[model samples]
Structure formats: structure tokens, C-alpha cells
Target chain A: MRRLHHWPLDPASRAARFALAEKGLDVDLEEARPWLRAEPLFRLNPAGGLPVLEDNGATIAEIGPVLEYLEDAYPGQPLMPRGAVERAEVRRLIGWFDVKYNGEVNAYLLHEKLEKRAQSLGAPDPQAIRDGRDHLRWHLDYLAGLLDERDGLAGPRFTLADIIGAAHLSCADYLGDLPFDEFPAVKTWYSRIKCRPAFRGLLADRLPGLPPAKHYDDLDF
Target chain B: MRRLHHWPLDPASRAARFALAEKGLDVDLEEARPWLRAEPLFRLNPAGGLPVLEDNGATIAEIGPVLEYLEDAYPGQPLMPRGAVERAEVRRLIGWFDVKYNGEVNAYLLHEKLEKRAQSLGAPDPQAIRDGRDHLRWHLDYLAGLLDERDGLAGPRFTLADIIGAAHLSCADYLGDLPFDEFPAVKTWYSRIKCRPAFRGLLADRLPGLPPAKHYDDLDF
Candidate 1:
């Protein structure tokens, strides 16, 4: 069995877990605090981040590597599309959510709403909260726009691109950050994703004091 | 020929350029200002980012997707290793450099040293410069440690991992930000990479007003 080191509310960790569950791989979970730089976590991943997977002797850290490793090592359920061009689209959207969305939205929203609490930091910055909300509107619009071209964010069928988008957005959603009414297409697409059996785990994860949005776990909203 | 829209000094663009050169792919380079989010650049990539690749009808944005497309489509000059674990290691290092190292070091150093100059954003923050230098020491040490286990950064064979690393570090090197003497192993490893014919184009790249460091383009620095 493999062992995964991750934090529950973290988007990367959620993606890794969801990917693992979607693949039907059994793994024991261990919580890790990357900021603490605890001896074991540091050694397991010199990069000092979450979603680190230790299978036998191989320790894979970083969501990019872990996601690819799952796709490559376990081909049971193909998260990546067949054609090179299609796969590039999936990975491109993955980058969009992981890099662009995370930077613009979650970096501010999650940090303010969640990580700050864990680190015992005081109140979230009003300006950063405003920035997060502002950036999120652009992302929601982009996601909704992408839906106009295809059934999913990246393509006709679901892929890791969708998985990653949901994971990242779920964080903001958990903080009641996303305005679903403004992005009807994204909301519809997300409703499909949120209802997946693999996503149940993500929906269940909650921070002690930070209650999720009223419709966060609801199957239909 | 494929076309690449990029900003020369950006590490991600440099990585894409170096990856193309390593793979013997000929691409006509068109410089784009991502910050400006000009009409054409935004049309190519609505995310408003650089290192976007247009091949045939497919437009690939972001270095992450571009590198993978090159490896998957053009197998002639393979930049990735054969095994799953090895490929994961290579990707891991790419993330380490692109995400961790870039955020901690280059995001500060490069933005301050280069992008700020381009945007006419006034002077670089001295505190940011100091912090970038401070963080770079740890990365150099980490790179030096990586070289201890394998001849190259990721493994015995040179791969995209090396390309991304060299592409990223070259930014600070041009700015005279790195202390090569302290990490002999990394310095030696970089020396080998810098001497590659593929790297010549990067070495030759010089911003108009910003002449590179004393030994920036030197093979035996």
C-alpha cells in the first residue's frame, strides 16, 4: 500500500486524493504541515510541500509529478486523453487552474480564509479578500466561457483538467468565495463534477471553524 | 515552422526555447508582452501569459504544456527519460524550479532586476533583492546536493530537468545574483549545461540596456 502525506483543505492534496480515489488505488493518509518543516515531511519531500506520495521506496512530491505519476504508473482509468494534442489541452487547463487560478484567486482567498487560521495568523486582510474575490470573477467567467466550446472545461469528456479545476475552486467555494449565480455554465459543469463519487471525499473535508458554503456539499443547487 | 510568443528574459519562456533547441525543433520566435496583455497575445492565450506555442492550428500556452507536447509529439529528440519513476523525477525537478525556486527566488530577483525595468516600474525593492539572495542560497545548496547523487540534476542522463534548471538560474546569473563559488557541484553541473550548443542562443540573449554579468556568457565561468 502507498502512503500519502497531505493536508485536507489543500487543493493540491485534494486533487491528489481525488485522483488516487478515481484510480481505485488504496493508500493510507497522513497529515503533514509543510510550514512546520517537520523532520520527516522535510526528508520525504525536500521541496517541503503537500500531496507527497510514498509508494514502496519512491517518494513523489508536488502535484504535477504526483498527477503524472498516477496517470503513467496506473493506466487503469486514463485521466489524460489519448491524442497528444488533446492531452496538451488537458495539461494546459491544469496549468491554468493550478498556476493561474491558484495565483490569482486561492493564493489570496485560501491563504486568508484557511492557511492563516492554521498558522495562528490573525484576521484576513480586507484588501486581499477583495482581490481574491475580484480575480475569481475573471476565472469563473473564463471557465464558463470554456464550457461553451466543450462539455467539460478542457474537452468533450471529463479529464484531469476538470478534476484540478474543481479541486482549486472547491477551496474558494468552501470559503463561500465563489458566486455561482454569476457563472451559470461553470455552476452547471461544477455540479456535474461535484456529484462524482470520487469528489465525495473532498466535499466531506472541512476545517474545524470554517464552515463550508450551504450548497458546497449539496448534490443539486 | 512552429511559432513561439515569448518574453526573452522570462524563465518559463527560456525553458520553452531551450526545450525546443534541445529537441532540434525550429520555431520562429515572436516576442510578446504578457504584462501588457496586448490584443494578439491575449487572443493567443486568454490567460495573458508568455511562452505560448502555435504549431499548425493548435496553440499551446504555458511552458508546462509546451514542453510535454514537444516530448510527446516529437519523439526524435527525447528530453524525458524512459522509465515512469525517472520521468516523475524530471517533472518533479521542473516543478521545483518552476514553482518553488521561481516563487522564492526568481519571482523576486527577476521581477525586480528585469521585468520592473521593462514595465518602467521604478527601482527594484532592496528588501526583495535581499530576500531573493537569501532564498537562492538554499536553492544552490539543494542543487549542489542533487548533483551529489547523480551526474546531472535529475539523474545520470541530462533531461528537461536540466533545461528548466539552467533556464531558470541563467536569469539570476545574468543579474549577477548567484554565488557560483559556494556550490562547486552545482557550478560544475551548470558549466556542462551552459557549454551545450543548445544553450548558445540563451547565452547570446542580451537585453538592450542591461548588459549581462561579467562572466554571464562565458563557458568556463
Candidate 2:
């Protein structure tokens, strides 16, 4: 069994959890308080980032690596496609969500509305929030376009790209930041992802001091 | 043969170039004035980002995917490692550079100092630049620590992690933004990367308005 140090509220963390569930690997979920600069966690990851996994004793910090490790180390359900080109496409989408989406959406909302100590770093700039919203809208449209072409972001099969995309949206959804009504295709895709057995743990997540939106846990919503 | 729409001075563009070089793939580089919102290119990528690659009529936008596509399509020297765990680590570092480094360093210096159009989007926030510099110093230190343990970022092999890290730093180096004196290990590692044949194209890059530092081209520097 692996030990995962993560925060249920964090999209990247949830993505890692989702990957683990897909692999059918049971992991001990230890909710991490990253801002406090927790001792062992800090030592494990000097960057003090989340979704740190302790397998045996070696700790994997970044979400990309953690997912790759799971898919590679325990290849059961085939989360990623076998073809090199297909794998590249999958990795590309994963990177898109992890980097581009995180920058344009998650970081702004998570730091602004969620973290109490964000003011110390710098008061959440309204322009950044506005910019984030605009960027997300464009990204959602891009996802819709991609979905229109293929069953999933990468191809016909559900892969890490879907997991990453859903994870970011779920975080936004928790804060009521997602405008699902604007993106019907994306909304329907989210609904499909929400119904997955792997997503049960994520939907059940309840972050302290930050309650999810009304439709966050509602499968039918 | 793939076609790359790129700006010589762009770090992301340089990264894509380096990835292609590593794969020994011949990519026809088309210098694009993205800011001008050029026809066809702008229409293909409405985001107006750089290093967009066109291969077999399919347009691939974004550095992460471009690199992955190259590796998948042309597996010469293996820019990424063989094992899934190793590949994940490489991808993780790539993300670190593309996102964390981009946020903490490139977004500040490249957009502010080089582009100068950032103020039009939002007044050039001095605090953000200061924050970026501080964050980059910490990241450099972290990179040095990582280099202290291994030959390359992931392990002994020279992976895409090295290429991505070097790509960003090379851009900063060109602008004389990096304080190499502070992190000797990073400086030494960079020196090693600078000697690579693949890096020659990056060294030869010249932006229209932004001139490279005096030491930019001197490999001995």
C-alpha cells in the first residue's frame, strides 16, 4: 500500500487520488497542510507542493510524475494508451491542464478565495482573477472542440488527460468558479467523469473552512 | 518533416527547437510575429502563443505536446527515458519548468523586460517582478540541490528535463537575468549544456528589439 500526502480540496491532489483509484491501488490518504510548511512533508518535498506520495520510502512530489509512476509501475487497467503518438497526445493534454489550466484558473481561485493567508503573499489582484476567468473560458472552449472530435481529450479511451481536466474543474466547481452553463459539452463530460467509481473519493471530499458549492457532490446535478 | 512557427527569441520556441534537434528531426522553422496577430498562424492558434508545430496537416500548439510528439514520432536518442518511473520524473521536471518556472521567472522577465506589453494588460507591477526574482533564486538553489545528487535532473541520462531547464535558463542568460554567481552548481551544469550541439540554434537566436547580453553567444563565457 502507498501513502499519499494530499489535500482533498486541491485539484492536483485529487487528480493523483483519481489516478490511484483508476489503477485500483489502495493508498493511505493523509491530508496535508502545505502552507504550514509541515516538517516531514517539507523534507520530502523541498518545494512544499502537494500530492506527495510515499511508496515504500521514496517520495514522489509532482502530480505528473505520480500519475506516470502509477501508470507505469502498476499497469492494470491501462490508463494511458500503448502507442507512442497516442501516449504523447495524452501527456500533452495532461501538461495542458497541469500547467496552462493551473496558471489560468486554479492558482488564481485557490489562492484568492480559499487560502486565508494569501493576503500576506499579496492581496488577490482583481485583474488576475478576471484574466483567469477569461483564460478558463477559452480553455473550456478548446476542450469542447477537442471533445467534439474525439470521445476523450486524447482519443477514444479515457486517459490521464480526462483525470487532470476533471480535477482542475472540480476544484473550480468547489469554489463555484466554474461556469458550466457556458460550456455544455464540458459540463456533460464532467457529468460522465463524476459518475466514475474512481471519482467517488473526490466527490466525497470536504475541505475545512471551505465548503463546496451546492452541486459539488450531487451526481445528478 | 515538420514545420515550426516560432520566434527566435522565445524560450518556449527554443525548447521546441532543442527537442527536435535532440530527436534529429528536421523542422522547417518559420519565424512568426505572434504579436501582430498574423494570418493563418493566429487563426490556427487563437491564443497567439509561440512554437506551434505543423506536422502531417495537424497543427500542434503548446511546448509540452510538441516535445512529446517529437519524441513519440522520432525516437532517436530517446529524449525521455525508457521506464515509466523515469519518464514520469522527466515529465514532472518539464512541468516544473513550463509552469512553476514560467510563473516565477519567464512570465516576469520575458513578458515585462522583453515584451514590455505586459503593462498594457495590467500596469507593470513592480512587486510581481520582485517576487519572480526571489522565486527564481530559490528555484535555482533547488535545481543545484537536484544536480548535486545526479548527473541530470532525473538520473544519469540526459532527458527532456535538462533540455527544458536549459531552454528557460538560456533565455534568462541571454537577457543577463540569471545571477549565475549565486548558484555555482547550476552555473556549471548550464556550462555543460551550453556545449551541446543542439544548443547552437538557441545560442544563435536574435530578437528584433531585445538584444542579447555581451556574453550570450560566447560559449566560453
Candidate 3:
């Protein structure tokens, strides 16, 4: 059986988990406290990060590769499109959300609200949060614009990009940071994703001290 | 003809350019000042980032997708490997450098040394620079370890991972930020990359007010 080392709350880890679920492949999930720098985990990933996958005798770290690996190894549900150009578009959106959204929005919120150390440096600066909020508005608008034309961010069908994007937004939603009403299209899209069986596991995720938002588990929210 | 909107000194832009050259594709390069956020470039990428590509009526932005597009559309030299598993490894390393390296090292260095506003915020905090230096040392060590086992980062043959990795390191090298001597293996790998014909254009990159390191153009330091 494939074993996945991940943290339930982490967007990247959730992305990997979502992909696995979408493909209908079962994985032995191993929750890892990445920030703690666990011994075997740290040794496996010199960078000491989460979302590592040990599959078929190969140890894969990084969300991008894990998605691609799943798509390649198990090609039934088709997480990515067949055409090269279409694949590129899907991959591009994934990169945009994974890198840009993570950098601008998710990281800021996670550091400020979830991680106390960042607060020790200073209280959660309203200005930084405000900036992140504004930036996320634009990103959500972009997603809405894309969803305006296509079923998914990339194209006509659901792909890894959607899973990854929703995973990040779900994390933000857990913190009560996502303004879903501001983006009606994105909100509707989220509703569809929330109804998926794969997302059921995510809704059950609960962090010790940091409780989720009221609407986080609401399917109709 | 393919057209590329980029800033010569930008590592992401250079990575796209390197991939294009490696594939023997001709691109009409346009110099874009990302900081200015010009209207034309903004239309191409609402984020107003560098390295946007226009090819055959389709516009693609972001380094990872651009590389994937090229590898797919023009498969002559094959910037990526044939096997699905090997390709996964390559993409993972590319993400490591582009996302992880960019977040921890390049972003700090660029914000401190290049962006005047960030520098003016404090006094180019010595501690931040020191932290970046230390972080880069570990990154170099990690790269050295990877190089120790394989001929290249991903596999036997040079892939897009190698090109992108060199692109980031080259940007740091220009600012004299990389300590090549600490990791002999990485230094050797870098020297090999420097000698490539595709790297010639990048070697000539010059940023205003930030001059290249004395040995920037030298194949051997």
C-alpha cells in the first residue's frame, strides 16, 4: 500500500490527499508535524517539509510531483488532460495557486493566526492581514473569471489544478479568512467541490487550539 | 514567431528563455520592467510578473508551464525525460528551486538588495541577510548531495530542472550572494552550466545600480 506523510491542515498535504482520493487510490496516511523537524521525515526531505509520498518503493516529495506521479501511475479518472497544451494550462494554474497564493495569502494567514511564533515577533498586524485580504480578493476574482468560461480553472473538466486550488482555499476557509460571498462564482464552485466524497475527510479536520470557522463544514455555505 | 515578455535579470524569465534556447525555438524577446507594472504587461499577466510567453496565438505565463509547453510543443531536444517517473522527479526538483529556493532565499535577497522600498523599510537588516546566507548554504549542501548521487539533478541527461536551477543560482551569483566554494560539487555543476551556449545571453544580464559580480562572466572563478 502507498504511504503518504502529510499534515491534515497543510494545503499541500491536503492537495496530495485530494488527488489520491480523486483517483480512488487508497493510501496509508501518516500525519507528520513538519515544523517539528521529525527525524525520519527530516532525513527523507532535507528541506524538512510535509506532503511526502512513499509509493511503489519511490519516495516522492513536493506536491507537483506527487500529483503528476498519481496521474501517470493511475490514469483512470484522468486528473490531467491528454493534450500537452491543455496539460500545460492545468499545470500553470496549479503553479500560480501553489506558489503565488501560498506566498501572498495562505502563508500570511497561517503565520499570523495559526503559528504563535510569528505573533511573538509582533501582534497580527492588521495591515499585513489587510494586504493579504485584498490580494486574495483579486485571486478569487481571477478564479471566478476562469470559472465563468470553463467548468474548472484549466479547462472543461476537473483536474489537479482544481483540487490544489480548492485545497488552499479550504485551508483559508478553515481560518474564516475566505470571503466566499464576494465571489459568487467561486462560492458556487466551492459548493460543488465540498459535495465531493474526497472533501468529506477534509471537513472533519480539526486543529487543537484553532477551531474552524462556522461555515467551514456547511455544504450549502 | 514566439514572443517573450521578460526582464533579463529575472531568474524565472531566464529559465523560460533557457528552455526556449535549449529547444532551438526562436523568440522575440521584449524587455519588461516588472516593478513599473506597465499596462501591456499587466494585460498579459494581471499579477504583473515577469516571464510571460506568447506563442502561436496562445499566451502562457509562469516558468513551469512555459517549460512544459515548450517541451510538449517542441520535442526535439527533449528538455524533459521520456519516462513518467523520471519526469516526476524533474518537475519536483524544479519546484524545489523555483518555489522553495525562491521563497526562502531569492525573495529575501531581492527584497533587501534589489527592491529599494523593502531596503528603505529598515536598514537592510543585517540579520535577515545573514539568515539568507545561512539558508542558502544549506540549499547548496542539499544540491551537492543530489549531484553526488546523479550526473544531473533529475537524471542522467540534463533536463528542465538543471536549466531552472542554474537560472536561480546565476541570479544569486550575479549579486555575489552564492558561496560556491562551500559546496565543490555544486560549484562544478554550475561551472558546467556556465559553459552552455544557451547560458550566454544570461551571462550578459546587467541590472541598474546593481552591478554584476566581478566573476559573473568568467567560466572559472
> Which regions of candidate 3 fall more than 4 Å away from where they truly are?
A117-135, A208-215, B108-131, B206-211
What are the per-residue Cα lDDT tens digits for candidate 1 across A16-93? 999998998988999888878888988888877888998878889888888999998998888988877898898888
Top model number, DockQ: 1
Stretches of candidate 2 exceeding 4 Å from the true structure: A107-113, A117-140, A175-183, A208-215, B36-43, B117-136, B208-211
Candidate lDDT (C-alpha), each? 0.88, 0.81, 0.85
Of models 1 and 3, which has the larger DockQ?
Answer: 1
User: What's the TM-score of each model vs. the native?
Assistant: 0.94, 0.85, 0.88
Candidate 2's chain A scores what TM-score? Answer: 0.92
Rank all candidate structures by their DockQ, best first, as comma-separated numbers: 1, 3, 2
Q: Once model 1 is optimally superposed onto the true structure by TM-score, how far is the C-alpha of residue B74 displaced, in angstroms?
A: 0.4
TM-score for predicted model 1 compared with the true structure: 0.94
Per residue, candidate 2 scores C-alpha lDDT tens digits across B29-100 of 898867777687766664567878888777777787777777877777888888766787787787788777
The DockQ values of the predictions, listed in order, are 0.79, 0.43, 0.60
Candidate of highest lDDT = 1
